[model samples]
Target: MSIPQFDWEACINLMLQAMQGAQLGLLRLLSWLHLARDIDGQPAWPFALRLSGEVLLIDHNVVRALVSALGCLVAALLLLALAVAWRRRRWLLLGLAVALVLLAPWPDQALLTTAATPTSFHTSPERFSAAGIVRGEQLYRQQCIACHGADGRGNTPLGLSLEVAPPNLSSGLLWRRFDGDLYWSLRHGKGGMPAFEASTSPADRWALLDYLKANAAGVGVTDTGSWPRPVALPDMALDCRASTVTRLDQWQGQRIRLVIGGTAPLPSEDPRLQSVLLGGQASGAVGAIACASHEATALRAIAILTGVPEERLAGTELLADRDGWLRARNSSGQWSQQDMLCRSPLASGSPVAQVAQVGGSGLDQLIAAMDEEPVRFIKGGFVH
Candidate 1:
């Protein structure tokens, strides 16, 4: 009689079918376990990974299914080898196979594949302007307010449902992150939060950054995202050249120009800035104040006033109108509208000097564009 052929292919097929059936059985058990745990009738599972723009549900059922599939496949192969070894009475082969299967290192390794995929995305160029901040504020109200609260304090009822509470955007912890980092976090949310990349536009993302910066600086930005009337200029003395404690109110009736001192010539020293001032003087309605304060303090003050980032404050100057309303802001030294007020390119390592203009205008065009309304300052104008 011919011995029945031991078909290796049929044995392998039977092992695979057994593995699949075991995996399905394990999955159903997991589902039953989940249903048993839902005493309050909320979502049965409390964990999720936020993907590109959607929540990747990772409830007990999913985790159990994956674990069961991997465990079943490994067990099936090991059992097949052990069966063959037992049939041949090879004890050493069975023992070695069991040892190797027990020592497999799948659980100890980090989730390297998952980590590599999420952080590969990029964000758009940052936009740092007052308008951007206002628009961002509006977007925040519509989308983020439900979780982060109207003040960005993350104290809302919905926020309490998360395993990890959402971070307060206005806190100092977020200060270390730049606009790019902020954009990335917003586009690809972590932990329990959902991603906003698909729901929010690139422009709106930049605006949200501007708004966050402004909010962090303690600006009392309203929840609706409207530009608050220019806060009252604090009574900080301008400390100009040849003038002591020069208050901002001194420039109230005429356009006030505050040029933060830098290597670029002081408004009083540079012929270009002077010529622009002369042009504004010709208009009979120009007031310029040169602030020689420390660069760090000046930057903070400007950030509070206009919501512009400090790095973006390079070059150019600040122009506020007669009613103490901010009219136009320049990013770099080049002023297109003013013919003679252009900032001369500074030689490398040029020394900075403090100079002040109690009354002048290097930006007549900007001054003219100022709102022609009576000055109205918000209460508690600026923080000390």
Candidate 2:
């Protein structure tokens, strides 16, 4: 008798397909439950819903309520099934109970406790506007600089004298916390920290947060080569010739190339991006918008965001996405896409190369890459 040959390749292919399908289904389930975490261990909520023509962002609270409702519905169904089984027979009830015990979702106790803990319902009223950040910087210097230091590293002598040394505001820990939680801490004293509520107004507190976040972002990028959180480009008043636009935020829906300081004449502006010049003689020059008012404040804010000295920012170039999220920085007087600070989530987890090896100009490649894998931001934080 001849033995039939086993189709090993076909079996392997079938197994692979099944595994892939299972993985995709699990991911969908996690996303729906709002339990998915990105590479950065931050919540990866799929909040954007594309409607007929525009994209609508669902509120986080609404999404949470929906998930809770779904969970409650599932529990009710299970209870109904168990009740029906109990009425049928005592043995059936026992069997159903056992099945449920085995199949029920048993989450970690720690995670359950965390979920049960009440979070502050309040959110920052300040939208992190450039004006808010400038006010924040002033407040920070006046109130926080004593303990937190000018750089926010909490390296000052007063910080060391505390029972619990002040935390480094420039660290990623600041981004990990909710803005409301931070607000509460500022309004009411936390361990070793004094209450600011007596001295600063509510608006001032929010502005302080903006400055800390902006400072932390710059320090983070300098230390780690990427933003710790999704940072909005600090909005500032702009002076544009032959254009009605008056502020940086008005350029939303278009990419911005911000040139801080360079001796060279501004390069021909790419149609894909709007060029904004700062700290140069080309104020009224062609192909770029210039900052006429608030130049000093704008320059200082940019310095905080880049972790570069005010003087050194002259030759720096920053790239902001269409959504106004700062994405990259190039210190070299020349433009190079390889200097991207916030890499695409789709990119291989490899360090950015020092030299450009891809085809076409660096700017073109960067724009294409950005469009292909746009940054995903959730609740003021970044999801890698």
Candidate 3:
């Protein structure tokens, strides 16, 4: 009889599979605890490694419950082994237990002392719609303008009089905090700030946050020439000629060229984009779709995103991606890639190189780049 050879390749494959499973389990646990870093936008390791389709369904709640039950079973088995070791006076088992105890992760006292909001309360129910932002602006004027100032820089006389100065809401601070934490602060108040729980409803507080986010995005771009985070184009009702679609969101799955002032001649029609003229007479223009009676509230919200006053918004042109994300802005002259905000990491080549390669207009190059690398936004944050 011939001697059987060991299946080294099969053994190695099994070991690798086991390691990958362990790593995936650890990642799920971290995500459940809200301790996992946002890796959706990253192009590097672990993030770049995608699981096979077979494992994708592991995210389902039923599968997750099964995994949790398996963990509990393993813990029970460990306890059983410990009891057996003690009862049997097994030196090796006791030694292993001591080693595990030495290597176990322990909570840091310093970190423990610091109070943290519950991880369960991380997301906000607010949708950050145009109407919500408009309401938010009204609330800001009523409740926050006294201390935060009209610019949200916290430079008012009332703000200066406080023992602890109000924080600059226009800065990147708004992007750093979780919505739930901000809501908690608004409800309970902090330091010199007064609580609004009595005066403002939950919906009102959320709307206020939406307004602040919009204001911050505009201010950040104005002050630093860059967006603090990716901003979604506020959704609004639209009057499209010869089209049944009555809302801006209905145009999803297609890119949009939004013209604010409508003073200049419309750009050459491109099959790739839908051009909608804002605040202009609907002359039944062939290439461009004219939206009539441009609602002031919608225009105001958009003006905030452009970092310009409503009166100056006439000449502005904005670009929104297929996903309804506001991508670029041009207030004067022709549009260029330099005007793009929330540029994608996956976009290939420098703007100059792209211009040479495409040999097209600046707007065309920007559209191409946007198609190449789509933006990924999640829960008020960019994946990248």
Candidate 4:
């Protein structure tokens, strides 16, 4: 039987499609694997998901298929080139070329970057108002209130049996925790909960947080807005600290305890020389003090130092608190609800924000605004 003519684009497309199909099948297969908790000492979430990807990658049958496709391509090319040089008939030469090209070995290029399909979910949602409270409430009512409850209580009949208790969104402990941590939970979805990362856009998630913060049923970071008469609220202690010590290895992970009233270093002993631990808290002895939230602080520092532009900072928060949670965030200044909804003390009441705004995405925009002069953020922590 005559071999088919060499079609480069078609062959490439087919190989790419096969690789993508195999990968997608592999992901679907993994979704079936009911992994028990705690495979290694580490958390089950990262281990199982990552391991699934690794395992799917090593399937020999899939590997063989990829190899076979490559081999065919090489063989076809060689035969086609030879036939063309010899002035052979178009159909015959092309067929022989394809047959020969089929002998080369390589993996499909399409498989390199796996595209995760967006997840779809359906639920009755709550709606909120413009200043952003009701809007957040509405979003929670739709996405979370079913499990957490309209009251922010965890007595949902459907969620009772779950090993992981649905957190009280209005609880003081929950709201006080970093917003990023809350955001992460919503995005990744712990335990049996499905991941809402792809489903719930970041802006909507924040709005939900705002509602949880505002109507937290008398919970959340104790809003000391109004104090008792005759006794004023303790002033927010000036946190301005200048440390020149560079070798961060000494006190990285330890939670450097700071007395809320006075930022004093405990005399009896502070831990020394720790790596930048995930949850940055100095146990009894060892400790270091970094930004409260990496998202709020880290990216800003990087931008100040690197001269990255404001617009370039991905909506992802960079500065992390001692617990590695995003207490504050340097979200994308582009079209974020916060610009219209919330105010930042750091932003100095201005909506236009930037991280590395000098050199990064905002370069063009900032450049146009300069009045025959340029400014540096060095004076403002890392920015100034």
Give the count of colliding residue pairs in each prediction: 4, 1, 2, 64
Error of 4 at 190 (Å): 19
lDDT scores of the candidates, listed in order: 0.44, 0.64, 0.65, 0.37
lDDT of 4 by residue, 11-123 (tens): 33344445435644554454557432321121122221211112222354544655576678766777677777877476787876665555445444523322121221111
Q: Candidates ranked by lDDT, best first?
A: 3, 2, 1, 4
Tens digit of per-residue lDDT, candidate 3, span 1-86: 99987553333334335544564566667666766653212111123233221221223333344344445555555855886858
The whole-model C-alpha lDDT of candidate 1 against the native structure comes to 0.44
TM-score, prediction 2: 0.67
Task: Please say which candidate is ahead in lDDT: 1 or 2.
Answer: 2
Q: How far is each candidate from the true structure, as Cα RMSD in Å?
A: 23.2, 11.7, 12.3, 21.8
- Model 2 pairs whose backbones collide: 261-314
Off by over 4 Å in 1: 1-127, 219-384
Residue 261's lDDT in candidate 1: 40
Indicate which candidate wins on TM-score: 2
Off by over 4 Å in 2: 1-103, 112-121, 280-295, 344-358, 377-384
For 1-384, candidate 2 gives per-residue lDDT tens digits of: 999775433333343344335534655586568666542122332323101100012133333343354465566567667777677675665565566555555321311112111122235654667677778999988888999998789999999899899988887666555465577678777889889878988888888888888988888888888886678788777777777877777777899888875665555566788787776553553444433334557888888888888888776788888877788787765556656777544243233342234567777666665665466543312122
Off by over 4 Å in 4: 1-60, 85-93, 100-142, 148-156, 159-202, 205-384
TM-score of each: 0.32, 0.67, 0.66, 0.26
- In candidate 1, how many Å is residue 376 off? 35
Tens-digit per-residue lDDT, 49-114, candidate 1? 211110101133333343545675577577667778587756666666566566544333221122
Q: How big is the positional error of residue 350 in model 4, measured in Å on the Cα after superposition?
A: 51
